[model samples]
Target: MIVSRGTVAFMFEGSQSEVLTEFLVSARSLSEYRAMFALSPRDLAGRDILDCPGGAASFTAEANRVGARAVAVDPIYATSPNVLAEQALVETERAVAWAHHHAERYRWDFYGTLDAQARVRRAAATRFAADVRVAPERYYFGALPSLPFADNSFDLALSSHLLFSYADRLDATFHVKALLELSRVARQVRAYPLLDYLGNPLDELVDRVRKELSTNGITTSLVRVDYEFHHGAHTMLVADRSN
Candidate 1:
C-alpha cells in the first residue's frame, strides 16, 4: 500500500506476519517499550510526519497522539496471496480504528499488560467488524515513485527498521537511493535500523548518511536512542534540506 499526500510516498510491509509482531505490540507504548530511537522529543505532537514501512500503524498511532497529521504508507496495505501471514487491508483499518479510540492506552496507559492490551485489540477488531472487510481510508491504496506530492512537502518523516529489512539489495548504492527518496520529500528525516543486523558500525552508518544527505543538499545529524533490545536502538538521523 502506498500512502501519500502530494509528492511524498511511504512503502510499508504488512503487519499480519510474525516478523513485526513484537514491534507492533511494543509500538502501543512506543516511548516506554522501544525508547531507543533518541531523536529529540519522544512524542511527535503537532508535527507532520510520514511513516514509511508503517507496521501495524505503530508510529503513526503515536504521531496521532501529539496531534500530528500522519500518513501510514506501505506496499502491503491489503495483502498478497503468496504472503498469507501479512496484514490485509481489513487488518490495517481495524488497527487504525483501535489506535484512534484507544489513543491513551497506546500512549501513556499501556503498562506491559499483554493480556489487557490483547483484550482491547480483540474488542476493537470486533467493533470495527474487521473480520468481514475493512473500510478503505482515502489513503489506503496508491501508486509509488510517483509520490503524488510535491518536493520538500513534509515537516518530519520517519522510517523504522525499513532500510535493512525491506531493501532487496543491501548494498551501499541501494541504501543511498533509499535515502535520496526519503530526503526528497521531507524537510527532516529519522530512520530506525537494526544496524547490527547489517554488520555495520553505528559511526560508519552515520558517516554514510551524512555523505548521502550532504550530496542531496541536506544536512544530517545522528542521535542514538537507548532502548532495551541491543539492536533495537536506532540511528536517528535528523536531516534538513539545504535546498
Candidate 2:
C-alpha cells in the first residue's frame, strides 16, 4: 500500500487504487507509548496525565495501573463500552491490514513482523475494551481544538497520530488551536510523529504550529524519540506553558 498526500493507496496483484478517507483509529500499547514519547518511569509515576484522541489504545489503562492518574478523552468514548470495544476491534483489523499492505513504508525493527504488530494491537484493544467497561470514569468524551477541562488540570498531556498525521484534513489553524488547548489543560504536552499518516514530513506545519504556540505563551520543541514504526517518524513535539 502507498498513500498520496491526501488519499490512501492500495495495490493488489497488479492494480493500484486510492481511497480518500480518515486514518484508522489505532490501538497502541503502553510500551509503544513509552517509546514514542520517551516516557520515563518518573513520567508515569504519581502524575496526572491526559491522552487526547486516545482511540483504542491501552495507554490510559496501563499508565494508571503503573501509578499515573491517566484519563483518555475522545468523542468515541460517548458510546457504550461494548459498542466501543466492537468498533475498536474492527478498526484494529483495518489498521493491521493497512500496515501489512504498506510493509515497506515502515520499520520492522520495533515489531519484527507484521504479525507481531497485529498481536500487540489486538492485545491492547482487548485490554482497552475490558478496562473501559470496568473503569468508565477514566475515559471521557471530547475532541481536539477544545476539551472539557479546567486550566492546569493535568501534569502532562500526550497526543498521538491525530494532529500531524491527518494534516491533509486538519489545517494549520486547527493545529494551532489544538496545541494551545492541550497546553491550556496540562503543564506539559507531548505529541508524536511529526509527519502525516503516509510517512510524509510536515516540517512546515510543525514550524508554523511551534511559532503559533510560542506567541500564545506555549514553548515548543521537537525531540527525538526511540520508537520508529513509521519510517522517519522518530520525533515528537513537546510543548510547555511558559513560566
Candidate 3:
C-alpha cells in the first residue's frame, strides 16, 4: 500500500505449513482507511460491509460501533490474536522503516510526514488489537478469489490495493475472478488506486476487469476520490451488480 496505490500493506513470508501461503496487508489505520476507501460515516450507515483482505484496519471496529454490519475477512484471523498482534507490530515497524527510508516514493499529501504515518499505523493497529480482545468475531479468517458468504450478503464491499497492485503476480484471470467473487457477495464493490505496486498504471488489466465485469451484468467505473497519496493515482473503481 505504500506505492501511492492504497493502504493495503502486507509482507510476503512465502508459503508456510503447506497451508499458509500468502499475506494480504490490510493494516492501514482508520484515517488511512478513509482516504484509501473514500469512506465516511454516511457511506456506512445501516449497511453491511465486507472488508476483503482486512489485515488489521480499524474500519470494522469503528463501523460496527456505529450500528453498521461490518466484517473483516483475512487469512490472518485463523491464527491466535496474540500471534497476529505480534506479527502486526513487526510489520508496522518494517513499514515505518520503509517509509522513512523511501519517503520520496510516497506522496505524503494526505499523511504529511513519516512521523504522522507511523503514528496513524500504530494507532490503527492498537485499536484493532483492542477490538480483538473484546470481539474477535469481527475479524474473520479468509482469503480472496473466493469468499464464503451467501449471495447479496453485504451492501458495500471494500477491497483496496491488492487486486490491481499485484497485477503482474496475479494474472488477468485472477483479477476478473476475484472481482467476480466480491461482486457476488456485495451489491457494490470499491477498489482504489487502480495501479500496480510500482506506481505504474495497470491499463490493460483495468480495462479487462471492467470488461469482464460488464459481461457478467455488472457495471464498473473509475470514480475520483478526495484522497491521493500517490501522484496520478487518484481514482477508485466502483462496481455495481444488478439485483
Candidate 4:
C-alpha cells in the first residue's frame, strides 16, 4: 500500500495490506531475540531459556528446532489457540488503525511501508500459531513478579514489551518485583526496549531498580544492542546474579 509522507494516497500493485495486517499481529523472531539479548548460538545451546510475555513469536519454537531448551510464559497461552488467533487479528487491526491515525509519530524505516509491515507481522503470527498446534506444552500461562516455576530453574531469562513499555500502567515497584522474579529464576536476566510506548526513556525507573538490585547483590547494566525496531530502543538492561 502507498504509505506517503502526509497521506495514504493509493495502493501498490498487488498490495497485501489486508494480508499483511492479518499476519503482522505481533511477534519478534528468533534473530530479534538473539540481538536484543546479546546471545549467540553457543550461548543458547543446551541452555534452559525463559521467554516472558512471549507473544505470537517463534523464538521458543525455532530455538527448540536447533538445540536450546526454551519455554514461553504469557497469559494468552491460557486461552485456546483458536481464540488467541482471533484476538490477535483484532489487535492487529487496532494497531494498524492507530498507526494510520498517527503516522507521524512512528519511523517506518524498519518496515519500509505499511503494507510490508503487515506482511511481516502476519508471517510471524502464522509461525507461532502453527507451533502451538504441535506443542502447546512449551507455553505456560502466567504473569510476573509471580511466576509458577521454582527458583534457579532457567539458565537465561528474557523479557520484553510488558514491563518498561507500559511504564504508565505499571509503576517502579512492579518493575522491581518482576526483575526479582526473573533474577530468581535464572543466572542471567535480560530485558529490552527499555522505553515507554510513547517513546520516553525509563531512566528513573531503571536507576531505581538498578540500585535496589545492587543492594541485593545483583549486578545490572545498560547494554547497547544491535536492534532498533522502535525509535530510542537501542539498549537493553542486563542483570546477572553476583557470585
Candidate 5:
C-alpha cells in the first residue's frame, strides 16, 4: 500500500471485474451511504458533472442516473490504505447498498434490493476507468494535484470530505487554497464540509465559498442541507456560469 497525507492508495493487478463481483456480495445494507445521493441537487439533469474526491462513486452513480456524463476523481488510487482489493470491496459494499436502499427515490428499474446492488456493482466494473496519471482537479483529466487545472472545465464539481478534514493538521492557507482551487476548476461546486471533522459552521463556510467564487468574478448560490437523516450540515454552492 502507498500512503499520502495519512491515506492509503492501493493498486490491483487482477481483472477489475473479479474484484467488483466480490464487492457487490458484501454490500448488504444502505445505512450511512444514503446521505451521499440524498443531498445531491436533483435539478442537474442533462448537465455534465464531476464528483471530486469521489469515494466509491456514489455521487458518480447519481449523476449517471440523471442522464449526465459523470466523472469521479479521487486520490485513493494513489494512496491505498490497504490492498486495492480490500478498498474496492469495502467501498463497493457501502456504495451499492446505499443505492439499492433508495432505488425508488432514484427511480431505478431493478427487480429487488439485491438486484439493485448487483446492478451498481456491474456498472462500476463495466465503467470504472480512471487514470491515476491525470490530475483530479483538472476535471477528470490528470494526475492528483499539486498541479492545477484550466479554468471553467466543469459544470458542477463536488467533494464530500476534502478541505474540512485538513483543518488543524494543515495550514489555514492550505485549506483556503484547496477550496479556491476547487472553485477554480468548477463552474458550479457543491461540497460537504464534514462537520464532525472540521467543526466549521456550515453557514460560515458557505459564506467563504461565496466569497471565493466572487473573488473570481463568479456569482454563487450556497444551500446548506439540514435534515434529520442527513444530520451533518453540508454546504452546497452552485457557481453561476459567466458565459
Candidate 6:
C-alpha cells in the first residue's frame, strides 16, 4: 500500500484499521503548493523561498524554473541522490495505496480521481529525483527548530504536511519552536492542513501555538486556501515576522 503525505501511523476516532509507524515521504507539485498556500505569481517572481521537510516534492525545482530561488531542506536529502530517488518512488507508491484505501477521508475535487492524483505525485517524485541529481545544491540537509540559514534569508518559507499533520507525535512546543525558526529565516511562513493525519482538527493546539507566537512577536493568522484533499482541511497557518 502506498502512503501519501499525512497518511502515516495514526488511528482516527473510528476509521482505518491498520497502523503505520513510519513517516511516509510524499511528493507534491508546485501547483499544489500554490493552491495550498494561496501563492500568487508575484510570490514566486524573484523571491527567495525555503521549503522545510520538503520530502520528495518538486516545488523547489519548479519554483526555480519560474524565476524563484527556492531551496528544499530535509534530512532525507542527506541520502545519495540515486538512493533517495529510488526511495521516493517506493514511498510514492505506498502513499497512493494509503490514500486509495482511505478514499472517503479525502475530497477528490482537486485531483478528480485517485489515478490522477497518483500520476501527479509520481511525476513530481520523478522531477524531484532528476533535479536533485542535477542541482544537488538546491536541496539541503536540515530539519526544523534549527536550520543552517542566516536570519531573514528567505522572502517566504513554505512548510506543508508536517506540523499539525503530525500533531500526534509533535507537541505544541515543537510547533511553536519550529514556526519561530522558520520565521527567523524568512519574513513570512505558511503551513498547511491545520489537522492531524486522521483529518481531525487540532484547534486547541493551533490556538495555543498562535498565541505563543504572538507573545514572541510573530503575528499569525488562519487563512483559508483553495486546496482541500484531506476533508475539512482548507486552512493554512500564516506566520509573519514583525518588521
Tell me the lDDT of candidate 6: 0.87
For residues 140-211, what per-residue lDDT tens digits would candidate 3 score against the true structure? 766777777899999999987778876656788888888899999999999977887557888888998899
- Predicted candidate 5 versus true structure: per-residue lDDT over 1-243, tens digit per residue: 111322122222255311211111122111222343243445356766666655444445444555666666554545442343355555554545544443433323222345755665644433332321222332232222332357766677765545554333444355445556656777766655444232444455445646765776767665555322223444444556454
Candidate order by TM-score, decreasing, is: 6, 2, 3, 4, 1, 5
Q: Per-residue lDDT for 49-149 in model 4, tens only?
A: 99987777778888898899999887667788766655555554555565555466566676688777666666666677778877888888877778879
Can you write out model 6's per-residue Cα lDDT over 1-243, one digit (the tens) per residue? 111233233322334545446666879999999999999999999999999889999999999999999999987777888877887787788877778888989999898988999999999999998999899999988878889899999999999988898887789899999999999999999999899878988999999999999999999999999999998999999999888
Name every residue pair that clashes in candidate 6.
2-93, 2-94, 2-95, 2-97, 3-94, 3-95, 4-95, 9-20
Q: What is the C-alpha local distance difference test score of each model?
A: 0.47, 0.86, 0.75, 0.74, 0.45, 0.87
User: What TM-score would each prediction reach against the true structure?
Assistant: 0.58, 0.92, 0.87, 0.83, 0.53, 0.93
Q: Count the clashes in each prediction.
A: 16, 0, 2, 6, 12, 8
Candidate 1, after superposition: displacement of residue 200 in Å?
5.7
Best by lDDT: 6
The true-versus-predicted C-alpha distance at residue 116 of model 5, in Å, is 15
Give me the candidate number with maximum TM-score: 6
Q: Model 6, residue 174: what's the lDDT? A: 91
Quote the positional error of residue 87 for candidate 3 in Å: 1.5
Q: For residue 25, what is the lDDT in candidate 3?
A: 48
As for TM-score, the candidate ahead, 1 or 2, is: 2
Rank by lDDT, descending? 6, 2, 3, 4, 1, 5
Task: TM-score for candidate 6, please give it.
Answer: 0.93
Q: Which ten residues in a row have the lowest lDDT in candidate 1?
A: 18-27
Which stretches in model 4 have alpha-carbon errors above 4 Å?
A: 1-25, 96-103
Model 1, TM vs. native: 0.58
- Candidate 4 colliding pairs: 20-118, 20-119, 23-121, 23-122, 24-121, 24-122
